[model samples]
Target: MVHVYGPHIFHTNDAEVWEYVNGFQRFMPYKNQVKTTSRGHVYSLPINLHTINQFFGKTFRPDEARAFLERQADKSITDPSTFEEQALSLVGRDLYEAFFKGYTEKQWGCSPTKLPASILKRLPVRFNYDDNYFFHKFQGMPENGYTDMVGQILDHPNIEVQLATKYRRSDRLDAIHIFYSGPIDGYFDYEDGRLGYRTLDFERFHFDGDYQGCAVMNYGDASAPYTRVTEHKHFSPWEEHQGSVCYREYSRACGPDDIPYYPIRLVEEKALLAHYVARAEREKGVTFVGRLGTYRYLDMDVTIREALDTARHYLPRAAARGHMPSFLEKAIAC
Candidate 1:
């Protein structure tokens, strides 16, 4: 199968899934260090200490840093309800409006005020000088690249993968099971409205030397056309390159013709997902798996873990029935 999408990084602590994937391909340890530009001040991403210091123009000890943020926070609102409110109550509206609001709007194609506060809950604020984007104990990219890793996964002798294989309900299915990773709404031909998604457009560039001095650089201002730039070669630092390739990612609402990049699980979309889930549960001879099937955004690690779990869960039922595990039929039907 073709990745079609951009680079995919697999990082997980699940031993079973890790072992299974590692058996197929090896990985290189790579950490994501994201930088951001706000009012021409360069800062580390996830709003770490360096970011706060740069934004506020102050240097403080760890304890002093905590106090500084506390002073900046508006304590009237006990619990943050919306992205706007969260920012206003915690860090004042300046940081939120300048750094988050515009970028969120560009990425989601909606104002941050319209989005639930839960969307911003994952954002981090480090009181120390750590700039690592993820808190996970393990993080990395594939040495051989994601396309190679996926090829290895589908290389099992028992597995048959067909690229450009369009699923027709009328296709002969007397005996095989289907593991579908297509869009949920598309499976039923969108009886209801199509689920919402955001797609990315990449602006590529070739440069002799480093362009931005970092792997990822976020343009926070709404005036900025592109949301962020990623240097793909830096993703794997084990190798050296005289030149570099970078992509400026622009996020926009996905149309029917566009490739869906991220599922936008707003309130209405969640209701629609439930409807699809119910329909899937009642159907037979199919198993819906992966990001597209599940209609939720999953990191590479979680996706693999879920796949492994699904396989394990269905294997026992298949053994009892004296049949090979049909990814779709055995699990969903049972």
Candidate 2:
């Protein structure tokens, strides 16, 4: 079996998801100190008060900080629609160039101006000292690590996991219900052209001691090729390791052979996705779930919550021999 560590920090408002994750007894809580490297300087992420003060070299108070940002914001962008417009409206040109422009371009393989404004909506600009990356009430990772936790979850008697097995369209399994979590386009053999995605290439290296002093360090310079560097050792701070392993992550447009990470829901891709969704609805006895199945990028918490909800929806339908509607109804909008 190939084991992959779940590097994402579990942070969400969903109580059910929180309770489920905690039940694993591997909760390792830590405040996310995400940093960005740009032009030989390091700054806190999400445009917090400290970052704002440091950027302008002025230790402004909370109220002053708010006013300072308002002044920095581009009043000309009265009705911002694109990502670039949204950034200018929120933080003005300097901060956008220093932080968002290069990183966004690197991650998406497109100019920020071409992307949707909604992409920047989740990013918060706080006028407080709270440097936590996510504002969610619960924030942490599995103690023993995600691979072990997932192994334990799969140890249940009811679950049957077949590792390294390939399921093709030609293959048939005897089952009451099927929850497909693979790529939606792949299910229909990409009759409509394949949707766009951004895949990552991790260049791993080892260090004798702590490197970068954080779990994730984003490179925001347009000249820098890679998007971020992630230190694996920092992920599980509860454990001690003499050496550290880090990955300089590079992002590129995904090809047929590459593993898809982030979905690129641009105009053309969305049109393709719509065609696939219509085809999925016409099909029978298969319900799509998870990110790739629905053609939307989803965080770990939302994915798990949706999976649990999908199971709940499936049970009743399975008992009554009724149809299970695709759990991700809003996937197209994503």
lDDT per residue for candidate 2 within 233-313, as digits (tens), equals 787777888888888888899999999887989999888888888888876778888889988878989989988988888
Tens-place lDDT per residue, model 1, 94-145, is 6787689878888888877777777777788888889888877667676787
- List where candidate 2 sits over 4 angstroms from the true fold: 1-6, 331-334
Compute each candidate's TM-score over C-alphas: 0.90, 0.95
Clash counts per candidate, in order, are: 2, 0
List all candidate RMSDs to the true structure: 3.6, 2.0
Residue ranges of candidate 1 with Cα displaced over 4 Å: 1-4, 322-334
Q: State the displacement of the C-alpha of residue 36, model 1, in Å, after optimal TM-score superposition.
A: 0.8
Clash pairs for candidate 1? 286-328, 287-328
By summed lDDT, which 10 consecutive residues of candidate 1 come out lowest? 325-334
